[model samples]
Target chain A: MLMRCIRAEMRKLRGAGIWWVFALLPVISAAYGTFNFMQNREILTNGWYSLFTQHTLFYALFFFSPMVGVYAAYLWRMEHMGGGMNMLMTMPVYPFCFFAAKGAAVLAVTLLTQGWVFALYMLCGRTLCGLTGWPPLQIALYMLRGLLGALPVVALQLLLSMVIRSFAVPVLIALVGGVVGMALVAQDAGIWWPYALVLLGMNANRAQDQLSGGLGVYVLVCLGFTALLCLLAQALLTRRDVRA
Target chain B: MRAAMLAERIKAARRHDLLLAALTGLLTALCAAVRPEEDWQRAVGYSALTVNLSLMNAVVMPLAMAALASRLWDMETRGSGCRLLFTLQSWESLFGAKALRGLVQNVVICLAEGAVFLLAGRMWGYTQALEIPRVLWLMLCTFVVNAMRFFALLALSVRSGTQVLPLAVGLACSLLSVFTAFMPERLTLLTPWAYDVPLSAMRMHYDRETRITAYEPLAFPAGLLAAAVVCGVLGYVLARRAVRDQEV
Candidate 1:
């Protein structure tokens, strides 16, 4: 039943304008990446890795975090409309199931964005920068790690979106969170800083130097944080009276 | 007119935009404070303040404007308020009131920011004294720039009936504006978001022979004024049309 609910939620998004965000975000990030890459070409001697690092930083800090926040807010928008929440509660489905399905859809979108971002990163490395040596293993690993890292952000956004009826508040917090995360990333507190996880995961400059234990710690932190957020969200959803 | 403005103030108070505006100001101040001392602790205090403030304005104000505009519009459109507002006053009057609210919010934010910048400068031990003319010039420029964005975004918000899109566009612009520091002044003038880029160039430059860091206001470019005027006119026209076309 839960699977059916999740699939239905995903199916409902077909032909919706929500997909434009996913399509446009990568292109926008790529354009910025290419711009920065070309601008720094004279100074950047580390080749593909340096360019990729800058690209991933821009993607993680600005584009990806806000996208998660907006995606979560968009998921709840339908229900938050006047009398919509009450109408939804009248349905036979449990609130937990409804929220779980929505959360799953958001996660799917996050992974989709991560996959496209990874593809664009590699493409930029190959064609634009003319780095022929394919770092396939590292690229795949970073992609998976980035996706895992983003899970906590996705869950937190979902939790916020579900709790706060105001659409902008969740997004505002997320944007502020992302901006703050950039500052936090330098401090090397990735275990506690979910916002910095995406940057830490896909950062070629830092990751290339310390890939083994560093990444494992990030993955563990991200997973633990994601689990805590998901559980908290579930508890909150179940306890909430449908008054929206 | 007084009644309309008063009512708008009450509505704005309820919406908590003033709080958001102040919060944004404090956040911008905090973000500016996070900068390494060397960046802002230049030989000439005026240059340092201008540079630091310009960077903060570029990064923070655009998003704040979008969010505040969207939130105000959303509050009006949430339920029957959208339909009811038109009945309470003429579309022009309603538009005026809302525009006034935005202006009030902007003024509050601007004042808060100015206070913080002064406090930050003093605390950071800026070597040069506080230069009023340059400080006032940047403040006025930022005010106009923010007002222009508010008008444009309010129009977009009213027409679209959603805050997220306009906010997203603003966020994207804010991201792009970070690179405006690198672009030529002429190109920066093309985008309203980079109104500060020219001023940001007025940093304490090192002289080769004298071995001194000279502090000066980069000549106020005529092109930025033109850009501000263009944005103002465009925003007004769009806003007029939006308010006129608003059904609910």
Candidate 2:
């Protein structure tokens, strides 16, 4: 059922509105990189990496994370919009299964979107800087660190989308939360700062020295918080929003 | 005219006050007061004030524009213009009225807060580049930027029934940052305000030789004004469609 729901979501995105967002992504990415290319053409490769490194969290905080959440919330909303919620609620499927399916669908879309971003970066690198080579091993490590960092953001967004009724509320909250997170990040006592989780996924290549010295408890702390957030999300869903 | 009806439609859709009040209160009370001083002796009283201003402007309120946008029409009663508003016509007029209303409301609240901060600073005998008026200027700058922002967003909501949360914010911050980043030496000779005041007065520059870049009011206001025009046009188009689109 979850897989089925994921397929449906893919099909639904085939609509004009959702595809416009997808189309807008590459254009925006290219535009932003072009802006960078114009300013610091010499550091194009490192610049792209740094741009992704710093901006990924910014994206998660303000845009992508909340987008995924809103996308999920709207899955429920689509039903309501179509006057199908009553039928869905009375269907043979468990209520939890319905949300679970939406969760899977959102995750699939997130990874697909991220994959597009990765491709966009590669393509932009080749076109803007006229380079045809892959970045160093540290680049992958940096991306991994970023993904790890974004884990909690993903979880929190999921929670917001799951419970919030208004289609716009969760994303709004996430945007507000993102700002608050960035301000308090430097003062963070530890990596448990969920907003700072995106920092966990940061490419430590710039500070290669830090990675070799050991992730210095930050990595574990991020993972710990990610786990904590996931548990909280699961519990929250079961209790109110996503029932079995 | 029918334009008044459409404006009322949009007005009913959104809830601007929630965003305004939350941002004002949050920035004043929570955002501005974070970890005030690393060490009191090292901290200039005004420097603390700058941190307060920076948080208040950049982090707290600017990003809420989308939420304000989302609410703009969501709060509308049946998504129609106020039957009573006699002054509106065309989608642009409706958008203008809403945008102007939002700007005035934000500015008024901000000014009221400025008075309190001004009195406090005078009591502390704090007189420097970071003055109450400068802070007020930053707030106004934020207000102008946000007015354009909220306007564009509400306009988008009118067109599409929903606004892209992240996209709206990225654009707003990048727009806002242009003003906040450089100060002192360079001429952002971009606007009257940037020219009238010290561009870097409210800015914090950590890594440059001059430390802060001078403000460029011209470029920012131009960008913001252009955004206002484009968004206003698009929002009006959306509202027109929404009015015509059969309810689902």
**DockQ of every candidate:** 0.36, 0.19
List, residue by residue over A1-244, the lDDT tens digit for candidate 1.
6898799778867775567667776776776777778877776667766666766766776557777888888888778878777876777877778778987999888888877877887788888878778765766777777788888988888888887777776777776676667666656665477777877777643636444667667777888998898889778867767663
Q: Please give the lDDT score at residue A199 for candidate 1.
A: 72
User: In model 2 chain A, where is the ten-residue run with the lowest total lDDT?
Assistant: A203-212
- iRMS of candidate 2, Å: 4.8
lDDT of 2 by residue, B145-226 (tens): 5555555555556555554443344334433343333333353333222221232244443445555323222222344445
Cα misplacement distance, residue B82 of candidate 2 (Å)? 11
Off by over 4 Å in 1: A204-212, B2-14, B34-49, B79-81, B122-128, B204-217
Q: List interface RMSDs for the candidates, in order.
A: 2.2, 4.8
Candidate 1 chain B least-lDDT 10 residues = B34-43
DockQ of 1: 0.36
Cα error of candidate 1 at position B149, Å: 1.5
Residue-level lDDT of model 2, residues A1-244, one tens digit each, is: 6667667656765552444454454455445444555565544445555545433434444445445545555565556443355566666665556655665666666666666766666666667656556755676666566666666666666666655545566665665555555555546432555755554455322333234455656677666876776677656545543223
